[model samples]
Target: MPKAQETVLEINLKALKHNFEYLKSKLNTNTKFLAVVKAFAYGSDACEIAKYLQKLDVDYLAVAYVNEGVALRNAGITKPILVLHPQAVNFKLLIERCLEPSLYNAKILNEFIAVAQQEKQTSYPIHIKFNTGLNRLGFCEKDIDYITSKIAETSSIKISSIFSHLAASEDLNEKEFTLKQIESFKTISKNMIESLGYKPLLHICNTSGILNYPEAHLDMVRSGIGLYGFGNSEKENKNLKPVATLKSIISQIHHIEKGETVGYNRAFKSDGFLKTATLPIGHADGIGRQYGNGNGFVTINNKKALIIGNVCMDMIMVNITNIDCKEGDEVIIFGEKPSASIFAQTVNTISYEVITGVSQRIKRKLV
Candidate 1:
């Protein structure tokens, strides 16, 4: 790719393919792959990512809301899209778009059933979510009987899969908790299978779960961060290539003398003569305010230029006194060298937050 002329996010499909194949290599030959393309494919272009993944023969796609699924459908994505958190209001639209919903509780299940029945649909695929441990969403173990009974009463919808979310599959310190969650999911699956008299597709592993727990890779595995080139650990990260590279160009250069302040609220007072490079990217572009005052740094001409003063809404000034750089020079916010994970660590956040927080206003170039 050529040097960025302006603030841009370069989405490398080759890197995405590499990450997908790498994650798939860990799964069994028969296991299915569900690419989670929610939150605009982790702040990249979801439609483009979904199109590429669909070409790669991904078994399924998942989005967090009905509108997201509808967006993919509008983008000509015909794969089975699992709406991970479908709401009652959009049940009609969800069905019209052929998007499957993950019914987690009694009210959602009953409401969806009513909508399916009203739509005169038959055997519409739906996923049942069980709250194994992630207490965020899903039915409790005790609700299995009610769920089965509710299913028995309606043929309008059918259980396509049973799934759960793992809270801490990435942290080894929570191994005991993760194992218990997996074991609980297994028990729930058994009971569900026995009650329903047939087995639905069983899956509970997310990207971290796919990396950390091989025993729990049931029928299918869902990967979000892994597909975006993060493994959630130092060892696994080495094997995955980052898919997004944020790049910008120096808009101007400024020479600051001692006692001169920079940016809003006079956040930085230069102690000595120095030069600064202003890049056209800031909080609005996802480089938050927390990454100011020497906390965050960017790469310029192969040198690390610390971000000085407070970050503005549309620009950030980085000290580049020693670096051999000029206006219009390429600047790297985060990429393979200073990966998103490393950049996010400056503000005590995670790659998921940083990557997904990128503003949609920035132009995305797919390569």
Candidate 2:
């Protein structure tokens, strides 16, 4: 546990370990694990999380872009870092740092091969991303032959692995779609292996994929939001612990008389005499302005406090009437109790959006 601060994001390492262990329990001993550290490890400090995951001996680390992989490399992370979306322009920097690029298209493939050959590289490892119904950045089934031909022409780069993304792994209602994706991935991978005469490691499962589609855990499994302590369902979630706790303190308490307006544009007005606590956190801290006017809330003194009035860029006023709190009382924006997922649903979103939306400017400390 960390001492309360005006505003802080506490990352519980113990919870992270628990989540990791639980997820690892779902995998076979032969399968490898990759931890997704993209989006600053979903806004919990990428470098720190990557370093810790590396210590856990994760087979791989993945990020959204080249800069993120570079950041991990600069932080002394030695695990193989995969940049999910690598532009041709950053091929030089990516190769220079030993960061792997997931070549999802022809331009990326051609451009990367050119750079690798120019650098006189031999057997440079690269991942091939195929489209398995995600309709995202990846080569389609029709392009498999062309991709194999291109790889055959290159000595500078070698196929490190092949992967695809699952579009609806979380929703049980979308089970058919997820299964179709797995089937397509299997067909494409089988063809690629026959063509190359050797099987490169194959992986397609994201966090939810690992939980819901255990049979599809090819050569490796990637854990993202799941690693952050969410399981995409009530039952799975019950066993995992939330790793990040967003906390703040009551900067002051104010007494409001009946009919008095509060905050900008009178978004909230007192109906009667009440006590409100001003918390030093707001939209800029990634809580967002829409999370106000009573739609969103915080917890104080183990009681709910509705967020009254429009959320400010740096502060929020909450109705604390009937709560036994005072100035400097600790407040929980979202954590193990209310959970980030529950809070995000109030805003018509998901846990990933809620956690990743947390502002990087806010301090993050590992416990």
Candidate 3:
């Protein structure tokens, strides 16, 4: 509740640790915990989050692209970094920075092997991704022999782990599909293990997957949103402490008479004498245009302030007629009260989109 700038994302390290420990408590002692820090650590500052996780002895860290892994490396993160979807052109850079790439196709596998050989690298760690059910970016069941035979030809790179992604792991209704995915992954991985002659660390569980599929914890587990403080279910969310609280100060206040319009294109017309407050946040800052037209709300003075007009690139207007607030009054966009999950639901999205969508222009203060 300290005085904040126009807009800020306050990251409570204490709450982050609380959620981390809570999720870790659900795992067995031997399960390797891999923290996914991709997308700026879910838009909470990747370097800072990865540094904290490294201190906690997190076995692995993951990012979507190679540059993200490079940023963490530049920040002095030396843990096993996984580039989930690496391009061939960055293969040399990945090797130079010691960032392991997840090779899901023959092109990436062959390219990485070529680079490793050129660098005289041997036994470098690389993760294998399989398309169990998600059908995103992963090798198929038919690619088992293709992968095993190819990797066996060279000692430049070695299989560090074999992993897959669950499609509907959190949905209780998709329990049957989740089980099938797990079984398919097991079958594919068994073929891999027998062919490779060694068991690389295997994993397929995201946050929801971890909560719903304890039996398939395999050799390790990966968690992203769970670490940032969100469970897929309301019951689980109650047990987790949300880590980031988005707050802003009321920049300006005005009183408009009936028939007066607010924002661009007369998107909102005042029904009566109404009070509104302008905030220094908008679509460019991650609360996009779709949130306008009364679709979003902010909390001020413990009262709900519905967004009354179009969300501009750098500002938004919220109805504050019912609340006693001033120009500098603090407002909560998403926090302990509205909660990221609650705020996201108001806009037909999830907490991940809301939190990670927060742009880098807004300063992140790690409290």
Candidate 4:
């Protein structure tokens, strides 16, 4: 248990190792695994996660930006890190840290090549991102000619991997659309590599693709959420252990008379005499206000407790009338019976958002 002075995020390194091994077991021996530690390792702690993964002999570590890669480097992580969405401004830093930048456009690729040449680098590794269907990033298949031309001129930069993102790999209902995207990537990857006279690693699979579409794991697979547990299917999740277990202590408790209201705006009016537990976490801590008014719940002694009223910035009230507990008792926001998945479902959202949205203000205590 963390000291009462601060709220802490308990990171289960054992669970993380378990999840990693579980995901690795599902992959072919030839398929390289690039653990995506972007967004602070899904808002847990990227540097720490990356360091642990480095020791685990992961094929690669991936971050969303050049700075994220630099953070790992600063933290003594020497493993190769792929910058998934690097920008032109940080091209020098990316080169300096020996981080591979994902070149999505001719402009960025040219800029990076220039930087690599200026730095006297020989064959600096870089990734080409094809916009199969994500639309948010990457170059379209039609732009393959422009990409090939850039790679042809830049002898200092080498294409390390050609990758694309699956827009909806988890949704089996979109099987046709997903297949079309995969085919597009296949066509573009083949044409560009052949034209440039170079063979780079070909990969286009997220967590879902690795699990549901094994054929899509061309040379490498980039997994984020799947490595930390929750799979595309609930049935598949049984093998992946959750790496995070959020716990908070009850700061105070109140025995309210019938008709008494709880929290701001009197959002929760007591039906009868009730016992409420005040937890030390609130919206500021990533328990969003949307979770209030009974929409979200937590576990107290393995029993469900209803959240009442608007979630304050520093506090939230849970109905603990039936629970036999006192102040300083632990109330699990997630991890136990009422898992984060279930809590997110109540508020019409997914577990990813809820877990990643957990504010950095909470100290993460890796176990």
Error of 1 at 2 (Å): 0.6
Residues 1-367, candidate 1: write the lDDT tens digits.
6899999999999999999999999999999999999999999999999999999999999999999999999999999999999989999999999999999999999999999999999999999999987889999999999999999998898999999999999999999999999999999999999999999999999999999999999999999999999999999999999999999999999999999999999999999999999999999999999999999999998899999999999999999999999899999998898999999999899999999989999999998
Predicted candidate 3 versus true structure: per-residue lDDT over 246-295, tens digit per residue: 99999999999999999998999988999999999999999988889899
TM-score of each: 0.99, 0.98, 0.98, 0.96
lDDT, candidates in the order shown: 0.96, 0.91, 0.92, 0.86
Ranking by lDDT: 1, 3, 2, 4
Better of 1 and 4 by TM-score: 1
Error of 4 at 233 (Å): 1.5
lDDT of model 4 at residue 183? Answer: 92
Candidate 2 lDDT, tens digit per residue, 1-367? 5548679999998888888989999999999999999999998999999888888888999999999999999999999988899988999999999999999998889999999999999999999999988887899988889998998988898898999999999999999999999999999999999888778899999888989899999899999999898999989899899989999999999999999989999988789999999999888889888899999989997899999999999999999988998898899989998999998888898999999999988999888
Model 4 deviation from native, Cα RMSD in Å: 1.7
The stretch of ten residues in a row with the least summed lDDT in candidate 4 is 1-10
Estimate the TM-score for candidate 1.
0.99
- Cα error, residue 347 of model 4, in Å, equals 0.6
Candidate 4 lDDT, 1-367, residue by residue in tens? 5433346777878888988888888888998999999989987899899889988999999999888899999999998899988988998888888898888887787788888899888888888998988888899888888888777776797788999999999999999999998899999988987887878999999999988888889899989998777886788777777777778888888999999998889988888998999988999989999999989988877888999888999999998989988887777887535656777899888878877988988988887
Each model's number of backbone clashes?
Answer: 0, 0, 0, 0
